[model samples]
Target: MKKNLVRIALGLALVLLTLGHSIRLYQHPLLSHLDAITYDARLRLTQPGGQDSRVVVVDIDEKSLAEVGRWPWSRDKVSRLVRQLTDHYGVQLVGFDVVFAEPDESSGLRVLERMGATSLKGDAAFLASLASLRGSLDYDGQFAATLKGRPVVLGFYMSNGIPQGALPPAVLPAGTFKGRNILFTSWRGYGGNLPAFQAAAPAGGHFNPLVDFDGISRRVPMLVEHGGQYYESLSLAMVRLLLGNVPVRPGYAEGGSGSGYAGLEWLDLPTPRGALRIPVDENVATLVPYRGGQGSFVYLSAADVLQGRVAPASLQGKVVLVGTTAPGLMDLRATPVGEAYPGVEIHANLIAGMLDGSLKHKPPYALGFDVVQVLLVGLLLSLLLPSLSPSRATLLTGAVLAGVVGLNLALWQSGLALPVAGVLLLILALYAMNMSWGYFVESHSKRQLTQLFGQYVPPELVDEMARDPERYSMEGRNAELTVLFSDIRGFTSISEGLDPKDLAHLINEYLGAMTTVIRHHRGTLDKYIGDAIMAFWGAPVADPDHARHALLAALEMQVELRRLDAPFAARGWPALQIGIGINTGLMTVGDMGSPLRQAYTVMGDAVNLGSRLEGLTKQYGVGIIVGEATRAAVRDGVFRELDRVRVKGKDEPVAIYEPLGLAGSVPQAVLDELKLWQQALRCYRAQEWDQAELQLMNLVRLNGDCRLYQLYGERVAHLRQQAPGDGWDGVTTFETK
Candidate 1:
């Protein structure tokens, strides 16, 4: 039993380990891409807006870059472009998707240094003019004052591992801050921040868009951590600035309402927009829904802004995003909607999503859904496979998979992020377990049963049985078999002084001897009711000689008990006395009870009579008692007359007998005693008590150890003193229960 437990534990452990590994494989990046595809398809089906004016991209093409010179055109040119859009075109909010960190090198600062301090007023004035021109090098002082307080947005970045450089002087307050509120998300590599541009812009946000491994931009970070402080993103900063606010004033905040996304309170901003409502995951990954390709929305070249090629009305009342979209500039990214996507377009989509209140959300119940799915799928497979045929089961499995996919799609369309890979993997595991169990565990169990029980049972019966089965379920129609009940006499007093462990050991040894005799005669061990054994001969499998088998088993058990007593004597334990009754009749025998649980048993009147007979054995002072039917069924003449006593709980008179020995094995002395007892029983039945007493006295003299002779001696003595009644049936009535 312990070995079986160890094997089961090892199997379960291996199964769990394999399941964990399979889940990890399913969560790999390739599967994530499949999940993304599924998400997109569902969104297309559900979201109200089509991939059109809802989202747009601006491109800084090769033509614009070629026409203007390599990247970073003069600040004067940038200033001119800003003027054309705001002054002439009237763009509502112009946000810069670019950064300028260093002072423009070609602004004449070197020339000013070359001029001596002793120079005349004209020379000094000339130096001042050059300095002014140099100040305009970043075109900062020029555009800075022009764009200041105007709805202009500037971009910044956050870093963790290493700073991309420092924040523009206009934003950083100096030193660092810590804890959850201090934000500047980590980043690596080197870059510069445009100090003047940051100073001029009314609001600025970080343009550090996070991309998942699948190259899809799905989420936006609201804040980032840098050094020991937190900083807002370009998109977020720009939105706050447009609202006439700065970094949010931190306080004790909570996540969003009920949806599992947390909430943050900013003293300046009114509330979180839909896009900002969701918190970034540990890796800063967010979901991005791409509208289409490069020219999907609107693209205005920098040169067009400067050359006045774009209509003033076009920028009027519009949110203008100033960023590079030039493919050669490497600002293009890969997204769901396009192979080559502008990085700046990701932010544009986020801003649009927030304004429209259409951002997707991962519902709070997603994790619950995963857990339930795993359990349900596992249990279903566990039960279903055991009862289904292979072909139909395969179809059922396919249907289940399709159903799971459909459900995942539905959840995604509802703007809930459901984990597809994990669920699919669990289902797959269930399928594998279902398939493997039949071929491996169940098959092996059957083989082991055949190997173990085949030699003991008939070949035909063996063929009909289940392998390693817990119960017998045979095709033979259910029928009641005679039940024989037996127990040791005076067991309570014998065990009173023994220690519990010793008592248990002694009882087991005594019961083991009797039980083996029953099994050897093809009896089904019904149950051990206390020290008594309730056994039946015909059950589960049929026995034609059921009554004969019971009688023979009872006789053999008495003989085995004598032999078993030897070891008990050595241990100072008392010898065991057993009473066995045998009878036969019709009764139902099969797996009877609930479908989930059942037991093989026999129940009927004949069975009850057999138990009553066993109880009567002590009253008659005999080791074995058999009902009239049992005596008639057995062809052997081993049974000798015992009594015609009415067993308790029964009104019917049963002729009980004690089996002495086989006719061939009967000794002359035993035969003489049996004859004498037979004569005494006849005398008692005839009411000839004086003659019965003479016969009992002679039998006791032959075998003083014989319990039956002593019992008859007492009966004759009692009957001799009683008056003869006309209605006397000569049946011995047991006065003790």
Candidate 2:
């Protein structure tokens, strides 16, 4: 109970730490990636735009520039363009991509000056001409009247390092645009504020890309830094006009912090369908739907519309964009779609998206999502260590990893923005902590277990046993495992000449080295018989890979013995050569004998077969011989079939395999010789005397004095003399061990 309480306290502490970090670093721009990820999710959740085909663009293309002679065309021409779009094409609203801040330069004012219109009489004539010129310019009052009741959105830019002036009193939103407070800095120039032109359009949006320092356009701010106070961007203002309302009036009558605008929720956009809530970034720039290409999305040329080149049906109700295509103008931006995208087109997509009820929002429930993740991981982690056994705990650990991945997939499918890295890190941290604490509490028993079995098993397996003592016992049991027996050839002679004390010391040294190899391969030492050692798998702890472990142990022991030879030679001792025999079958394996005299061991027919094969290893003249059962159990393919033999006390003919180094690293000659010998064995078993004699002769020449070959040759010679009958089963009875 106390452990559970401690775990809960730790989980709560981690959650609080995460919460504090988020709030403290909320204002930093680096955290914007989270918002970026959120925006991407929004796009996937929302529907595609261009559903109603309400908004359209009257583009200004190269052909139009050719006909009208360069950009910034005379206002008289713009006024006509506006009039045609409204009156002829029946276009409902006209939004200008072009801004007119300065007064009309070509208003013929210079002509009046050149004509010397200084007095009142001349001034009156000049004024009449100016009025006519205004009338001829882009539908000034004529277009304004059309936009009165209908929805219209205009375009403008914010100062990069300065601020745009407040709207004139005549053009301000009635109640919202109060108090005639104006501040001007002459050093910073504000462009695109043509008083007469702006007055004509009902509403406007800012055409700006919130480009980062690295020139990557990621986020857009809803409020722009203008003058001493923040002003809503062009998109926000346009949305307000679409809703038949305006930005909320800030009631800073006392002149403290601006709390009056706190209740402002979302700007509503006006379209042919109806007013729609258009959620936006702090600044009006839309999250670019970058398609990763230069010319990814469809870009229709505006020149086709003016020349009657494009089909009428194409522009009948489709949203068209009117923006500059000139390369030098640099109105292009890097968007999610492409590196060079027209800035004016992004707003068109955004407005269309907003009108179709396709905008996405995360709301404030994202915090709740984080809380859920912490609770899930923490609870699972806290329960795992205290409740599960070691092996079961390991299985649960794997399940936890899989569970995390599954949760992430589910949340993504549901269109939720779940924090990934933070939650996963929390799970990992908690898991490690619990496991460490569990180890700490059981350290004493673990230390004792390690001391007892450290020389008999790998350290990793020792740690596993130490983690959960209840799962394992030294009691005996019958299980299928591979047993290996190795005996040094001619060891009796060497020991016979040595002093007894020196011989005992040397044997201990050799056994110590061999025991290390066995433990490294996860084999439990069974016992020692004079100059021989016995080991078996599936003891104290069961290894599913028992056969593989036995084979590896044999190979490693050979290598270690070779390494020991150099040092032994320096000490005037003969190099050691040993033969190992391995057999796989069911055996009673565990701690046996009386309580006061217990030792880990295995006993069964399989164990006896292993000992008998070790004796036959001298007759085969091989370093290691493995029964067919053992070879089949090995996953590493390290053994090659040698022959079938009937050992003493065993009636069944057993296939034997020679442990030939590693599978891939064996020498080609060794493999070839083994194949030749295998063919000879097949011939001998088939009673094909001539073929068997020829193959056995080749084998004897390549590696002479093998007891099986000598024995076979003597039998074949006798068979040639006696002419044995077909009743012979090709069985060679062995009187061995």
Candidate 3:
């Protein structure tokens, strides 16, 4: 319980730390920039890419310069271009993305006026012509006259550096905002159109975009505060004119810091048609909902507008923005969709969005929504991870992540912009914490179990237990398993004849070879006595065919002993002979033994029976002996029944047998000898001494030096002489092992 609590606490701590860090650094420039990048990707992913019929771009591209006289063309020609847009194309409104900061010098007005002022003094005829042509020579006045009261909005730039050019009055007076301390982008300087143009145009606005820290134009302020008044943006001004000259006011959300402040989030416009709410971010900025990369709107060359080459249907009732797409003009900017987007199209997109109410909303309450999302996901996973298995936990985490992404995309499609990175980071942090707990805590226990298994079990079984350590353990338990016991024949006499060092070397070599055979059949090594070996099958790992496995190991041990005989002869050592006995029954197996003397082994009557069977192998003169239960479990093995004996410490008489090999692999001669031997044993059991002795003589004739057959013959002869009553059952009883 304490460990589970600790795991939960660790998850919570990780969640709290991550959420706190994200909240504290929420305004960090790097995270803000990353958030903006994801917002841009969403915009591009969901934005409808098609021509915006309401707004059109009058591009002053390379073709325009090639056709026209070049940049800074005579103001008279510019005025003519403006007249063409208004009269010929039936344009609703015209916005200049370029500023007339300085007077047109190409008109030759200053030189002609200078000649009249000093160089051409006393020249009445030239003076009269100049005075008469004064209106025609003032090209700046001509451009201003064209702009006068025709729904023309001129664009200007707000700056942090030194202010340049003529300035215009604020659209909203300073101190007009109410409630709390509001922060908007403030500028001390601006570069605007000439005074005459400012006075002549009915509406004009600053066109500076809110280029992010990464220098990408993602948003633009709808209103900027200067001194005390608020100036409108070019897109906002254009929208205002299209809405019949609505008045814009600072809009506030209902609930806030109780300072009633929380800053400006949007702009409210009261139009004669209806009031409209223009959503803005915290900085009173609106994200630019780009329709597509470039060419989202109709594009016509300024050269074409001037030459009257455009179709009327193309420009009729369309709002036009006059801006340059030429590289020399440097009016292009980096935006979310394109690296070289015309600065003018940004205004067009904004204007079109306001007209149709398609602008994406990112209100102040979105912060609260984001916090709730992060909390719900983080806490849910943090609480859930500790209780589930690793595979289940991973599946749950994936489900939650997919849900988060699905919700975020749904909100995006609804035109509501919410942050995704914070929630993403929160999920990852929680998952990492949970996975780390599983690795450092649970895996440590698993590693210990694997090491223990390696010591007493085969590598294949060890790997199976390592995958799930709890499935196998050293705790004592009763299970139906198979046990095997093996001992060398006359080991004490052989060891006493050899030197101590030679005996040790021989024992090690023999035990090593026998162990290899046992391991080959996936049997567990229980323990080793001085000249005996004890092993079992079925666990530390489970094997359903434990009986068969033990039988195979016993058979192979004799085979390996044959291979070692040549080496033992070369060392001047007698060939080793071993007898193995196997039994299959319920036994208690685990790390048993007292604390200062512990060993992994098996216990129970079945184990004792296995040892007694090994002792009887010499009595029967056989290499392998098995109890009746073991022979019953191994179906395909060839076994010959030895006898039914009530061994010491057991009340029931148990039958024993000798296993030769698999039925298919044993020779026919061996099978025939076993048939004759079994007939002699049956005849002896029925007290037919003559028949048993005659059968034994035939068996001895078939196989010479058969001690088991000879011993049975002697038992039959003795019983024939000693029998006195019919109470004889012919069952052998072993009083010692």
TM-score for each model: 0.49, 0.43, 0.58
- Write candidate 3's Cα lDDT for 1-737 as tens digits: 45568767877776675566456644656456667778888999888999898898998999999989688778898899889999788899998888888888787889998888898978999999989888988988888888886778888998877777766668888657645566589998888888898888888889999888877998899988776678989999988887787888666676332445666777778876666878898888998889998999989999988988998898999899999899999988999999899999999999988887889988777877877887888778878887888889899999999999899899888878988877776677777776776456457767798667787888777767888877777889999999999999999999899999999999999999998888889999988988899999998888989999999999999989999998899899999899998999999988888988877789999999999999999998988889988999999999999889888899899889999899899999999988888888888888788999999999989877877887887787787778835887667888998
The alpha-carbon deviation from the true structure for residue 83 of candidate 1, after best TM-score superposition, in angstroms, is 1.8
Query: What tens-digit string does per-residue lDDT give for candidate 2 at 329-437?
Result: 5677765444676666655555555554554333234556766766666566655555566667667766886787577656654534345555555556666665666
Note each model's CA RMSD in angstroms.
34.1, 22.5, 29.6
Best by lDDT: 3
Q: Candidate 3 — number of clashing residue pairs?
A: 2
TM-score top scorer:
3
**Which prediction has more favorable TM-score, 1 or 3?**
3
In model 3, residue pairs whose N, Cα or C atoms come closer than 3 Å (at least 3 residues apart or on different chains), thus clashing, are: 174-228, 174-229
Question: For model 1, how does the per-residue alpha-carbon lDDT over 266-385 read when each residue is reduced to its tens digit?
Answer: 212455541234323433334554554555457777777778787755566667777777767777776666667777877777666555545565543555576567556655654565
Question: Which scores better on lDDT, 1 or 3?
Answer: 3
For model 3, state the Cα shift of residue 251 in Å.
Answer: 2.4
What is the Cα-based TM-score of model 3? 0.58
Q: How far is candidate 3 from the true structure (C-alpha RMSD, Å)?
A: 29.6
- Each prediction's total of clashing residue pairs, residues at least 3 apart in sequence or on different chains, is 37, 27, 2
At residue 4, candidate 3 shows an lDDT of: 69
